[model samples]
Target chain A: MTVKLYIDSIHDALQEEMRRDDGVFVVGEDVGVRGGVFRVTQGLIEEFGEARVIDAPLAESAIVGVAIGAAAYGLKPVAEIQFADFILPAVNQLISEAAKMRYRSNNDWSCPLVVRAPYGGGVHGALYHSQSLEALFHHVPGLKIVMPATAADAKGLLLSAIRDPDPVLYFEHKALYRWIKDEVPEGEYTVPIGKARCVLEGDDITVITYGLMVHHATEAARELEKEGISTELIDLRTVAPLDSEAILAAVRKTGKVLIVHEDNKTGGVGAEVSAIIAEKALFDLDAPISRLCGPDIPAMPFNPPQERFYMLNSEKIAQAMRQLAAF
Target chain B: MMNAQSLEVPAMIAKRHDKLGLTDHDVVKMYHFMLKTRGLDDRMWLLNRAGKVPFVVSCKGQEAAQIGAAFALNPVRDYVLPYYRDLGVVLVFGQTAKDVMLSAFAKQEDPNSGGRQMPGHFGSREHHIVTGSSPVSTQIPHAVGIALAARMKGHNLVAYTSFGEGSSNQGDFHEAANFAGVHRLPVVFFCENNKYAISVPLRKELACEHVSDRAVGYGFPGVTVDGNDPLAVYAAMKEAVARALDGQGPSLVEAMMDRMNPHSSDDDDRTYRSKDELEEVKSHDPILSFRDYLLDCGVLTEASEKALREEVTVEINVATTYAEKAPYPHPEQALRYVFAE
Candidate 1:
């Protein structure tokens, strides 16, 4: 195992997968000669040649639509949208075409494509650059949504996503791209999709989260450990096929729950997690499920103070945990 | 097959048909396909009015262009991504009359979607015809992608995608054209310029004169053909297919036709189209014009035409009855195919 930046793991995973499968190719704006604006796909064009690592015109819809067609024709294409906010133009292709290919064709065709985008606030990206769009796709049925918080999960989950038989929307939080680093296993290994990882285990309160919020929750869990409060941290790797069993087990053990995310409050992943706990494990709870999420504003503001307040941090998560524990 | 009787023809029509390289038997086959498509379209309207079928989108005046383009490609190798009103195209590409009836009835035997999608959403893996959705021009990029895949795998195949004139204004069309042009993918963008998009006329759809002219912006050749002349359409499509197979890049071929019927069974076209305008469109109906050309060229006689009509009537009736009696999918199977087994 070797420690690496969160973005390096993703880059390594792409290189490893491309080397493993000839059908696996990457395409997007600036992914080839420019090496992507964030450099996640740096040096891929030199290694894989232009055909495999294409730099497409700046059209999101065409990028995704072409990938869908390629996937249908037996090519596994990993397309990148420069930013999560720019993914709206390609939603029609993703939802109507790629997602429905398997179901509509009645198993005659399948689109094994992955669309990667950088999401979440911080780095002063503002409204157009920083947006958490997991909820927009969570309601879609034929898609799988993955947002990894750690370098190890990023590499493992991406390898799994590229090999899967359906379309996956993989959101890598921009804020955690370089800030987070961990020991990622070498060689080819995939962390199973639709499963959650228990980052830190405790007994007093269960905090279920994903993406960058997992780090904030982990920090808060460490802080609470000093105050005699035990918080169980669960990182939901895949949001669409929620790991309900893992969430329920955590709730049953802790008897208290707190769901945190950087996305908006309404119709977020937190709502779904709360509903699941309320439906099957309502009797197991000692206190009501609490949520710490971004405010219901249009988007993250450009101002430093406003953006800081708009994002969920360790201090806010710890306060929510203390409130839920006291309840 | 042509009958043993030698029928005479006017020299002018014979010269034109001969120039297209279509023999007597090929012209008759093209006529047969057009008639069959028209018969099926008419039956669908009857079924829609009788409350047997839910919806009907007619391809009445576009048969010549559809069949012309279909014949120009190798159905066994090339891929076609046809739009919702491509009944004639799908028929020529190997979808049987029974397949059409099954889709209209929304029966379990429907190959496209197993009764899931609406009628006219053509698809058949065995025939290499890609499935299409209801959206206007989404298939444009999909066709480019398929061609891109073919090029990557080093296959000498082209992808043919078609849409209405109004859909040419859609972003999917332009984006697809740009990508295909930049990559020089083996694709043919066939536009059936039916003059209207439901209620909107072509005047409102675009400020340009012809839809094919937009292909120049993507750095490819664009040609406009008289869609009423199957021979002319065949000539244009034949060249386009050859260029694609030769890896010369994509071409945009605009078949100038008209929509003779209302948009769908539910629409009352009289609200938008004038009686004089409808009469003008019907005057140049491609099926009738193609029949005249065949008769003038001695490829078809009165007796043979009568025999062909009888054959189509019987075929459609048998397909209708079989599809009507077919069963719906079992309720328990509704959730199947959502995920790979």
Candidate 2:
């Protein structure tokens, strides 16, 4: 039995990786002394020295660039951006250099670096703080984008991401950092990239989601069960190398599909999944595919009504399932 | 790799030919390389004009400095992370003129691109030259990275990367220099300050007196050399490379050369600058000054100089022809070279 382990999974992953490998080090603003704003890196500086738990200058590009350099030089660096929004400054390093290094160099050099950032909405992080920008990274090839929904998966995926040969952007939803916890293996384990897990299996309507939205979808699935509508909830563990087979199978069985993400409605991961379904399994669909996501403009405000309206919740997921089931 | 001690002084003087170098062979080689580079530049410009090639960032005025720097290290070992305007440096680092021409032509036979990259995006694994990209100052950190790798591997090899004055404005430049200094990596950050970034003057881009002065802030030794004088540039690079190899750390050396050509084939200087300004810079061309120094040293006689120019012209002409005749890459091959399977 997977015993319920209620702890900071990200912190657990960091501790495990740091202990497991000599090269594994964490570097970020306030990550060392302050233990990060959310305390994800708490007690790491005490465990490992300052060199391993580096307190870098407040330069995102430098942080990413230095990590790339360190990784190429044979150190496994887990660099954290205090917030996901501030990752823009280092976008070029991540997108251009880190992504294309292996491809352009013909695999002469591989950047085995992991950039961990706390992302997604629901903590009243506002515009600058809360953002589901995984789609932006998902669009770029040669990069692996992982957004773990569960505590167990978070530890496994974070470890795998650290060990992976290519650069991995491990986007940790700030909402799920401590809000949701389950049995995460105490020993070393890895969840394969490009594999989606059916967290809750049903056959009526398939709801594809990832990260914090997975929990939301599960809530919606339970609510739908009360109405005799069995919903299949899939958590897309890795966004970039998506598990098309799993998605195709789910669609084939359920004959109906609803893609949900915390990102903006237009051009979200749902759009890509929709396109993939259209391209591959259009005939398998029983009804038109639907997407439940934040309204497309920018991240919404912290106001109770505006936040409730703009953010996608279990209610929104249930609404989509009802509409899809009715069709 | 060749013995560093034997090549150090000669290579240094070869790099900065007008300085107090007592060697005649070094000056002659400097003249030869400059002439060779200038010839290639002239051919490439004509190729662009004649519609045989698409684009070029000519290294005509910066040959002496580029070649002198190239001569400072063993081409077989030290890795060079060159920029678009570093054709001369690329050639000196063991890339064939034909290979570079084919790259410019975007042919399937182009070693640099394999028909994937645009013209002047040069790279050669055989030459230990890391691939060049269009992004400004991106290679600065990569060079430091390679140096860091070499240092970790316990190989005393140095990484040399060069870019224009414009590239110094990039945040990557600052980051790479800072990290290299902090880690004491064996890397040389060569800033080819040609006074103008395209049409944007150095004054508009930088408030500092020279590009090298910024190195002091990064906690490394910085020096400004007469980039037009290959001897001075070579001397500076040798000193820097030696310091790095001896585990001293990275150093920044600004080569104050001239931007004789417009920023690239796509750019026209006449749109932004007067002919007077163009002529003023052209008068101090590195190739011309190096040629004069060779003549003074009696290393390059009129007959020899004529023969050398003819030889280089023919070599470049043959390369141009080979590039033109080379087949364009197949449409399906576009996705081939992105990564190694």
Candidate 3:
């Protein structure tokens, strides 16, 4: 195992997958020579040449639309939307074309494409750049949404996403790209997409979250532990196909649940998770299921203080956890 | 300034057609497909009015352009991403008359969607025709992507995509044109400019004179031809296909025609179009003009035309009966194919 940054794990996964499958190729804006804005695809152009590592024109719709076509024609295209916010332009292609290709064609064709974007609100990206779009896309049927919190799962989950038969939206948190590091295996390994990992095991309250918020929840869990409140944290690896079984199991064990995410509370994955637990396991819950998420503002503010207030940090999570634990 | 008959079949029309590598039999075959498409469309309108089908999007005046362009491409090798108004194109590309009827009936045997999609959403994997959605111009980028893939795989194949003139204004068209131009991918962006985008006329749809004029910004050749003449559309598509095969990047071929029918069963062109305007456009109908051309060239006789019409009618009848009796998909099967099985 080698200690690597979260971005490095993603890069390694792309390299390994490209080496493993000839059909795998990368296309996006500045992905070739510029090696991507975040440098996650750095050195891929030299290794794979210009044909495989394509630098497309600054058109998100074409980037994804062409990837869908390529995937339909038996090529595994990994398209990058420079920022998750820019993915809206390509949503028609993603939702109408790639997502429905299989069902529309009655299994005669499938789009095995991976769309990777850096998402979440940190680093003061503000309005356009800083946005959590997973909730907007979670309702889609054929598409899989994955956001990994740790470097190890980042590598494994990305590999699995690339190999999956359907289109996968792999959202990487930009804030955790350099801030988070973990030992990822040297060889290939995949974290199953629809399974949640038990980040912290406890008996009092269960914390269900994903992406960078998982770390904040973990910190809050640690703080809660000091106050004699045990917290069980489940890092939901994939959001679309919610691991309801794992969520219910965690909820059954703890009886108190707190869903944390960086996206807005309304219509977020938390709502779906909360709905699932409320419908299936309301009897097991000792306290009402609660969610601490970003406010219903359009986006994160430019100023640091406003941005911090808009985001869900460990303190806010701990505060929520304290209330739920006391209840 | 040329009259419809003169433009349809001039004295040297046969010689010009021969120069383009089309035999007398080939022109007759093209006319046959055009007739079949028109017949199927006419039957669909009738069925729609009689409450047999849910919807009908007629390709009445666009047959020559669609068939002409489809004839130029190697159907077995090349890929086609046809818009909804491409009955003739799909027919020429190997979608059978029965398949069209099945789709119209929304039957379980429908090759396109198995009774899932609306009638006009044409697709067939075996025919190398990419499926399309109802959204205008989305297939343009998809065609560009297929061409990109073909070039990357070192395959000598072109991806042909067709859309209405107004669809050229869509952002997908511009993005696709720019990408194909930048990559020099093998693709032909064929615009069947029927002069209307669902009741909106050509003048309102574009600021420029021609849809093909926008191709210059993408660093590709753009040509506009008379869509009423199959020979003209055939010539344009032939050049576009050749350019694609020679790795000369994509070309935008805009075939200028008129939408003779209302947009669909749900639309009323009378509200937006005049009686004189409709008659003027219908006078240059490609099917009738092409038939005249064939007759003038001695490629089609009155007796032979009658026999061909009879054959098409029989074919349509058989397909219609088969599809009408075909079962609807089982109610429980609605949840199927949402994921790969």
Q: Per-model C-alpha lDDT, please?
A: 0.91, 0.82, 0.92
Report the C-alpha lDDT of model 1 over A156-265, residue by residue, as the tens digit: 99999999999999999998988999999999979998999999999899999999999988999999999999988999989988999999999999999999999999
Which 10 successive residues of model 1 chain A have the least lDDT summed? A101-110
Model 3: fnat (fraction of native contacts):
0.72
Report the lDDT tens digits of candidate 2 across residue range A1-327: 254332377788789888988778887788988988888889999999776787776778877877876676577889899889999999998888888766665455568889999888878877888888888888888788999988888888998999887889999888786678787777787888789998888989999999888888899999999999998888999998899999898888898999998899787888999898889999988898888878887787877687777788888789889999999
Candidate 2: clashing pairs of residues: B15-B68, B15-B230, B15-B231, B16-B230, B16-B231, B16-B232, B17-B230, B17-B231
- On lDDT, the candidate that comes out on top is 3
Q: Which prediction has more favorable DockQ, 2 or 3?
A: 3
- TM-score, predicted candidate 3 vs. hidden true structure: 0.98
True contacts kept of each: 0.67, 0.26, 0.72
Root-mean-square deviation of candidate 2: 4.7
Per-model DockQ against the true two-chain complex:
0.78, 0.38, 0.80
Pairs of residues at least 3 apart in sequence or in different chains that clash in candidate 1: none
Off by over 4 Å in 3: B1-13
lDDT of 1: 0.91
Task: Give lDDT tens digits, candidate 2, residues B149-220.
Answer: 566456788889898999999998998888788778788999998888888988899998988889988889
> Residue B112 lDDT in model 3?
93
